[model samples]
Target: MRLNIHTLIHPTIQKLAYEIIYQKSHKKLQNTDNEKTLGMLIFYEILRKWLKIDNIYIKKVDVLKERRLSNQLDKYLIITNIIECYNILADVQRILPEPYLKHIDFNNINNSFYCNEKLQEYRIIIFEKFLKNYGIIEIINYLQKNNQINLNHVKIICLTCNSNILKYLANKYPQLNIYTIKIN
Candidate 1:
Protein backbone atom coordinates (compact mmCIF):
# COMPACT_ATOMS: atom_id res chain seq x y z
CA MET A 1 0.00 0.00 0.00
CA ARG A 2 1.25 3.46 -0.98
CA LEU A 3 0.98 6.15 1.68
CA ASN A 4 0.94 9.88 0.94
CA ILE A 5 3.37 11.48 3.41
CA HIS A 6 3.16 15.10 2.19
CA THR A 7 -0.11 15.69 4.04
CA LEU A 8 1.50 14.56 7.28
CA ILE A 9 4.22 17.24 7.07
CA HIS A 10 3.77 20.19 9.41
CA PRO A 11 2.78 23.62 8.09
CA THR A 12 6.16 25.04 9.19
CA ILE A 13 7.92 22.41 7.08
CA GLN A 14 5.82 23.42 4.08
CA LYS A 15 6.71 27.04 4.65
CA LEU A 16 10.35 26.03 4.83
CA ALA A 17 10.08 24.43 1.41
CA TYR A 18 8.49 27.59 -0.03
CA GLU A 19 11.23 29.75 1.48
CA ILE A 20 13.94 27.44 0.16
CA ILE A 21 12.65 27.79 -3.40
CA TYR A 22 11.83 31.49 -3.24
CA GLN A 23 14.94 32.62 -1.37
CA LYS A 24 17.42 31.27 -3.95
CA SER A 25 20.00 30.77 -1.23
CA HIS A 26 21.87 27.83 0.26
CA LYS A 27 20.17 26.03 3.11
CA LYS A 28 22.12 24.44 5.95
CA LEU A 29 20.74 21.09 6.98
CA GLN A 30 22.24 20.30 10.40
CA ASN A 31 21.29 16.68 10.75
CA THR A 32 22.32 15.51 7.26
CA ASP A 33 19.15 13.44 7.22
CA ASN A 34 18.26 11.81 3.92
CA GLU A 35 14.80 13.37 3.80
CA LYS A 36 16.08 16.86 4.58
CA THR A 37 18.81 16.68 1.92
CA LEU A 38 16.34 15.45 -0.65
CA GLY A 39 13.96 18.32 0.13
CA MET A 40 16.77 20.88 -0.20
CA LEU A 41 17.89 19.45 -3.55
CA ILE A 42 14.35 19.65 -4.86
CA PHE A 43 14.11 23.23 -3.67
CA TYR A 44 17.41 24.08 -5.40
CA GLU A 45 16.12 22.73 -8.69
CA ILE A 46 12.90 24.71 -8.37
CA LEU A 47 14.82 27.92 -7.69
CA ARG A 48 17.14 27.35 -10.66
CA LYS A 49 14.20 26.84 -12.99
CA TRP A 50 12.30 29.86 -11.70
CA LEU A 51 15.30 32.19 -11.97
CA LYS A 52 16.37 30.87 -15.40
CA ILE A 53 19.89 30.72 -14.04
CA ASP A 54 22.24 27.89 -14.89
CA ASN A 55 25.48 26.61 -13.33
CA ILE A 56 24.19 26.83 -9.77
CA TYR A 57 26.03 24.71 -7.21
CA ILE A 58 24.75 23.82 -3.74
CA LYS A 59 27.29 22.90 -1.11
CA LYS A 60 26.59 21.25 2.21
CA VAL A 61 28.02 23.26 5.08
CA ASP A 62 28.93 21.95 8.52
CA VAL A 63 25.92 21.65 10.78
CA LEU A 64 25.58 23.44 14.12
CA LYS A 65 24.14 22.15 17.41
CA GLU A 66 20.42 21.36 17.55
CA ARG A 67 19.91 24.38 19.85
CA ARG A 68 21.36 26.69 17.14
CA LEU A 69 18.94 25.43 14.53
CA SER A 70 16.24 27.78 15.76
CA ASN A 71 18.47 30.86 15.42
CA GLN A 72 19.66 29.85 11.94
CA LEU A 73 16.11 29.20 10.86
CA ASP A 74 15.05 32.60 12.15
CA LYS A 75 17.74 34.37 10.07
CA TYR A 76 16.80 32.38 6.99
CA LEU A 77 13.14 33.14 7.46
CA ILE A 78 13.77 36.88 7.81
CA ILE A 79 15.87 37.10 4.64
CA THR A 80 13.44 34.96 2.68
CA ASN A 81 10.49 36.98 3.89
CA ILE A 82 11.99 40.23 2.57
CA ILE A 83 12.90 38.59 -0.74
CA GLU A 84 9.42 37.13 -1.09
CA CYS A 85 7.84 40.53 -0.52
CA TYR A 86 10.03 42.09 -3.25
CA ASN A 87 9.21 39.25 -5.65
CA ILE A 88 5.51 39.70 -5.01
CA LEU A 89 5.77 43.41 -5.76
CA ALA A 90 7.67 42.70 -8.99
CA ASP A 91 5.11 40.12 -10.06
CA VAL A 92 2.31 42.59 -9.40
CA GLN A 93 4.03 45.21 -11.54
CA ARG A 94 4.54 42.74 -14.38
CA ILE A 95 0.91 41.61 -14.35
CA LEU A 96 -0.53 45.09 -14.00
CA PRO A 97 -2.21 46.39 -17.22
CA GLU A 98 -1.95 50.13 -16.65
CA PRO A 99 1.25 51.67 -18.04
CA TYR A 100 0.23 55.22 -17.22
CA LEU A 101 -0.16 54.31 -13.58
CA LYS A 102 3.41 53.01 -13.55
CA HIS A 103 4.75 56.22 -15.03
CA ILE A 104 6.72 58.42 -12.59
CA ASP A 105 7.62 62.01 -13.25
CA PHE A 106 11.36 62.65 -12.92
CA ASN A 107 11.46 66.36 -13.66
CA ASN A 108 12.05 67.29 -10.03
CA ILE A 109 15.11 65.09 -9.70
CA ASN A 110 18.43 66.72 -10.42
CA ASN A 111 19.91 63.76 -12.34
CA SER A 112 16.86 62.22 -13.94
CA PHE A 113 16.22 61.78 -17.67
CA TYR A 114 13.49 64.41 -17.61
CA CYS A 115 15.71 67.03 -15.99
CA ASN A 116 16.41 69.80 -18.52
CA GLU A 117 19.06 71.61 -16.48
CA LYS A 118 21.83 69.32 -17.79
CA LEU A 119 20.70 69.07 -21.45
CA GLN A 120 23.45 71.25 -22.86
CA GLU A 121 26.35 68.89 -22.11
CA TYR A 122 25.08 65.63 -23.68
CA ARG A 123 21.81 63.73 -23.49
CA ILE A 124 20.01 60.81 -25.19
CA ILE A 125 16.30 60.10 -25.41
CA ILE A 126 14.98 56.63 -26.24
CA PHE A 127 11.52 56.86 -27.81
CA GLU A 128 8.75 54.24 -28.08
CA LYS A 129 5.02 54.56 -28.74
CA PHE A 130 2.48 52.27 -27.13
CA LEU A 131 -0.25 54.01 -25.17
CA LYS A 132 -0.76 57.43 -26.77
CA ASN A 133 1.18 60.09 -28.72
CA TYR A 134 4.22 57.79 -28.55
CA GLY A 135 4.89 59.16 -25.05
CA ILE A 136 6.89 62.01 -26.59
CA ILE A 137 4.36 64.48 -25.32
CA GLU A 138 5.04 63.29 -21.81
CA ILE A 139 8.76 63.77 -22.26
CA ILE A 140 8.29 67.14 -23.90
CA ASN A 141 5.93 68.26 -21.22
CA TYR A 142 8.46 67.12 -18.65
CA LEU A 143 11.17 69.18 -20.31
CA GLN A 144 8.90 72.16 -20.97
CA LYS A 145 7.75 72.30 -17.39
CA ASN A 146 11.29 71.89 -16.09
CA ASN A 147 12.53 74.75 -18.29
CA GLN A 148 15.64 72.87 -19.42
CA ILE A 149 14.88 70.94 -22.62
CA ASN A 150 15.88 72.72 -25.85
CA LEU A 151 17.00 71.72 -29.35
CA ASN A 152 20.41 73.33 -28.84
CA HIS A 153 20.90 71.41 -25.56
CA VAL A 154 19.87 67.94 -26.78
CA LYS A 155 22.51 65.78 -28.43
CA ILE A 156 20.53 62.83 -29.84
CA ILE A 157 17.12 61.16 -29.82
CA CYS A 158 17.39 57.43 -30.43
CA LEU A 159 14.24 56.12 -32.08
CA THR A 160 14.37 52.38 -32.43
CA CYS A 161 12.05 50.67 -34.96
CA ASN A 162 9.63 53.60 -35.28
CA SER A 163 10.50 56.34 -37.76
CA ASN A 164 6.91 57.59 -37.91
CA ILE A 165 6.89 58.27 -34.21
CA LEU A 166 10.26 59.97 -34.47
CA LYS A 167 9.03 62.20 -37.27
CA TYR A 168 5.91 63.06 -35.38
CA LEU A 169 7.89 63.96 -32.28
CA ALA A 170 10.33 65.98 -34.37
CA ASN A 171 7.46 67.94 -35.90
CA LYS A 172 5.67 68.43 -32.63
CA TYR A 173 8.75 69.31 -30.61
CA PRO A 174 10.72 71.19 -33.25
CA GLN A 175 13.22 72.41 -30.67
CA LEU A 176 14.16 68.81 -29.81
CA ASN A 177 17.42 67.39 -31.17
CA ILE A 178 16.63 63.98 -32.61
CA TYR A 179 17.94 60.92 -34.48
CA THR A 180 16.37 57.68 -35.71
CA ILE A 181 17.51 54.06 -36.11
CA LYS A 182 15.75 50.85 -37.25
CA ILE A 183 16.68 47.90 -35.04
CA ASN A 184 16.17 44.58 -36.81
Candidate 2:
Protein backbone atom coordinates (compact mmCIF):
# COMPACT_ATOMS: atom_id res chain seq x y z
CA MET A 1 0.00 0.00 0.00
CA ARG A 2 1.91 2.98 -1.32
CA LEU A 3 1.07 6.19 0.53
CA ASN A 4 -0.39 8.98 -1.57
CA ILE A 5 -0.15 12.52 -0.16
CA HIS A 6 -2.95 13.73 -2.40
CA THR A 7 -5.49 11.22 -1.22
CA LEU A 8 -7.61 12.40 1.72
CA ILE A 9 -8.71 8.90 2.74
CA HIS A 10 -5.30 7.26 2.62
CA PRO A 11 -4.21 5.74 5.88
CA THR A 12 -1.28 8.10 6.22
CA ILE A 13 -3.45 11.14 5.63
CA GLN A 14 -6.14 9.79 7.93
CA LYS A 15 -3.53 9.29 10.60
CA LEU A 16 -2.22 12.79 10.03
CA ALA A 17 -5.71 14.28 10.28
CA TYR A 18 -6.46 12.33 13.43
CA GLU A 19 -3.22 13.43 15.01
CA ILE A 20 -3.89 17.06 14.13
CA ILE A 21 -7.34 16.89 15.67
CA TYR A 22 -6.17 15.10 18.78
CA GLN A 23 -3.30 17.49 19.30
CA LYS A 24 -5.51 20.52 18.78
CA SER A 25 -8.23 19.41 21.18
CA HIS A 26 -5.92 18.05 23.83
CA LYS A 27 -3.36 20.85 23.73
CA LYS A 28 -5.51 23.86 22.86
CA LEU A 29 -2.97 25.08 20.33
CA GLN A 30 -3.84 28.42 18.81
CA ASN A 31 -2.46 29.96 15.64
CA THR A 32 0.42 32.34 16.08
CA ASP A 33 2.25 34.70 13.66
CA ASN A 34 0.26 33.55 10.59
CA GLU A 35 2.37 30.39 10.55
CA LYS A 36 -0.63 28.20 11.26
CA THR A 37 -2.56 29.59 8.32
CA LEU A 38 0.39 29.08 5.99
CA GLY A 39 0.87 25.55 7.28
CA MET A 40 -2.80 24.70 6.95
CA LEU A 41 -2.89 26.15 3.44
CA ILE A 42 0.12 24.12 2.37
CA PHE A 43 -1.28 20.96 3.97
CA TYR A 44 -4.83 21.21 2.60
CA GLU A 45 -3.57 22.33 -0.79
CA ILE A 46 -1.75 19.01 -1.11
CA LEU A 47 -4.81 17.10 0.12
CA ARG A 48 -7.25 19.08 -2.03
CA LYS A 49 -5.38 18.78 -5.32
CA TRP A 50 -6.55 15.22 -6.04
CA LEU A 51 -10.04 15.31 -4.50
CA LYS A 52 -12.97 15.61 -6.94
CA ILE A 53 -15.06 17.39 -4.30
CA ASP A 54 -12.38 20.01 -3.68
CA ASN A 55 -13.96 22.21 -6.32
CA ILE A 56 -17.13 22.53 -4.29
CA TYR A 57 -15.35 23.13 -0.96
CA ILE A 58 -14.52 26.68 -0.05
CA LYS A 59 -12.01 27.89 -2.61
CA LYS A 60 -10.25 30.55 -0.55
CA VAL A 61 -10.26 31.28 3.20
CA ASP A 62 -8.55 33.86 5.35
CA VAL A 63 -7.71 33.41 9.03
CA LEU A 64 -10.85 35.19 10.16
CA LYS A 65 -12.99 33.25 7.70
CA GLU A 66 -11.46 29.99 8.78
CA ARG A 67 -12.06 30.89 12.41
CA ARG A 68 -15.66 31.84 11.75
CA LEU A 69 -16.40 28.78 9.64
CA SER A 70 -15.61 26.56 12.65
CA ASN A 71 -17.14 23.48 11.10
CA GLN A 72 -16.51 20.13 12.84
CA LEU A 73 -13.32 19.33 10.90
CA ASP A 74 -12.11 22.92 11.02
CA LYS A 75 -12.57 23.05 14.77
CA TYR A 76 -10.21 20.17 15.30
CA LEU A 77 -7.35 21.28 13.04
CA ILE A 78 -4.08 22.00 14.84
CA ILE A 79 -2.55 24.93 13.03
CA THR A 80 1.26 24.86 12.93
CA ASN A 81 4.41 26.27 11.38
CA ILE A 82 7.08 24.59 9.22
CA ILE A 83 8.96 23.34 12.25
CA GLU A 84 5.75 21.97 13.72
CA CYS A 85 4.99 20.35 10.37
CA TYR A 86 8.37 18.65 10.57
CA ASN A 87 7.75 17.66 14.18
CA ILE A 88 4.40 16.15 13.20
CA LEU A 89 6.04 14.11 10.47
CA ALA A 90 8.73 12.97 12.89
CA ASP A 91 6.06 11.98 15.41
CA VAL A 92 4.13 10.04 12.78
CA GLN A 93 7.27 8.32 11.56
CA ARG A 94 8.16 7.38 15.11
CA ILE A 95 4.65 6.20 15.99
CA LEU A 96 4.06 4.15 12.84
CA PRO A 97 5.70 0.77 12.41
CA GLU A 98 8.61 0.19 10.03
CA PRO A 99 6.46 -1.42 7.31
CA TYR A 100 4.27 1.68 7.07
CA LEU A 101 7.31 3.94 6.72
CA LYS A 102 8.63 2.06 3.67
CA HIS A 103 5.42 2.78 1.79
CA ILE A 104 5.25 6.46 2.76
CA ASP A 105 7.11 9.00 0.59
CA PHE A 106 9.12 10.65 3.39
CA ASN A 107 11.60 12.07 0.89
CA ASN A 108 9.00 14.28 -0.73
CA ILE A 109 8.30 16.12 2.52
CA ASN A 110 10.31 19.14 3.65
CA ASN A 111 12.64 19.52 6.65
CA SER A 112 12.10 17.71 9.98
CA PHE A 113 14.01 16.56 13.06
CA TYR A 114 13.73 13.54 15.31
CA CYS A 115 15.28 12.85 18.69
CA ASN A 116 15.79 9.31 19.88
CA GLU A 117 15.92 9.62 23.63
CA LYS A 118 16.67 5.94 24.15
CA LEU A 119 19.84 6.26 22.05
CA GLN A 120 20.48 9.84 23.20
CA GLU A 121 20.77 10.84 19.53
CA TYR A 122 19.37 13.57 17.33
CA ARG A 123 18.53 13.33 13.63
CA ILE A 124 18.10 16.25 11.32
CA ILE A 125 16.20 15.02 8.28
CA ILE A 126 16.45 17.13 5.16
CA PHE A 127 14.45 16.59 1.97
CA GLU A 128 14.41 17.91 -1.62
CA LYS A 129 11.54 20.23 -0.83
CA PHE A 130 13.88 22.27 1.39
CA LEU A 131 15.63 25.30 -0.10
CA LYS A 132 18.81 24.01 -1.73
CA ASN A 133 20.98 27.04 -1.11
CA TYR A 134 19.99 27.82 2.49
CA GLY A 135 19.49 24.27 3.73
CA ILE A 136 23.02 24.00 5.13
CA ILE A 137 22.74 27.47 6.64
CA GLU A 138 19.50 26.58 8.37
CA ILE A 139 20.98 23.39 9.78
CA ILE A 140 24.02 25.29 10.98
CA ASN A 141 21.80 27.81 12.69
CA TYR A 142 19.85 25.04 14.40
CA LEU A 143 23.06 23.37 15.50
CA GLN A 144 24.37 26.63 16.91
CA LYS A 145 21.20 27.16 18.92
CA ASN A 146 20.99 23.59 20.20
CA ASN A 147 24.66 23.36 21.16
CA GLN A 148 23.89 21.00 24.02
CA ILE A 149 23.60 18.10 21.61
CA ASN A 150 27.01 16.45 21.40
CA LEU A 151 28.42 16.45 17.86
CA ASN A 152 28.98 12.69 18.09
CA HIS A 153 25.29 12.08 18.86
CA VAL A 154 24.00 14.26 16.03
CA LYS A 155 23.20 12.61 12.71
CA ILE A 156 22.41 14.41 9.51
CA ILE A 157 20.10 12.45 7.20
CA CYS A 158 19.66 13.83 3.73
CA LEU A 159 17.61 12.49 0.86
CA THR A 160 19.65 11.76 -2.28
CA CYS A 161 17.70 14.53 -3.96
CA ASN A 162 19.78 16.93 -1.84
CA SER A 163 23.04 15.11 -2.46
CA ASN A 164 24.92 18.25 -3.36
CA ILE A 165 24.13 19.88 -0.05
CA LEU A 166 24.87 16.63 1.78
CA LYS A 167 28.25 16.36 0.09
CA TYR A 168 29.14 19.90 1.02
CA LEU A 169 28.06 19.40 4.66
CA ALA A 170 29.87 16.10 4.98
CA ASN A 171 33.06 17.55 3.55
CA LYS A 172 32.90 20.70 5.68
CA TYR A 173 32.11 18.84 8.89
CA PRO A 174 34.02 15.59 8.66
CA GLN A 175 33.23 14.65 12.27
CA LEU A 176 29.47 14.85 11.73
CA ASN A 177 27.59 11.60 11.09
CA ILE A 178 26.02 12.17 7.67
CA TYR A 179 23.96 9.62 5.76
CA THR A 180 21.92 9.80 2.58
CA ILE A 181 18.89 7.78 1.53
CA LYS A 182 18.12 7.48 -2.17
CA ILE A 183 14.44 7.76 -2.94
CA ASN A 184 12.94 6.62 -6.21
The alpha-carbon deviation from the true structure for residue 77 of candidate 1, after best TM-score superposition, in angstroms, is: 40
Clashes of each: 0, 0
- Cα displacement (Å) at residue 165, model 2: 1.7
> Which 10 consecutive residues of model 2 have the lowest summed lDDT?
70-79
Error of 2 at 114 (Å): 17
Q: Which pairs of residues have clashing backbones in candidate 2?
A: none
For candidate 1, the TM-score is 0.28
- Give lDDT tens digits, candidate 2, residues 1-184: 1111122344443444444445555886633423333333333433232222212244455533222221222111111123434433343322212201111123332445332232212222222222235445454544545445444444333322244554555555556643322321
Candidate 2 segments whose C-alpha is farther than 4 A from its true place: 1-131, 145-148
User: Model 1 over residues 39-135: C-alpha lDDT tens digits?
Assistant: 3333333222222212434455864333211111110000011221222223321222211111232222233333323433322232221112344
Show the colliding residue pairs in model 1: none
Top lDDT model: 2
Model 1 weakest 10-residue run by lDDT: 71-80
- In order, candidate lDDTs are 0.32, 0.34
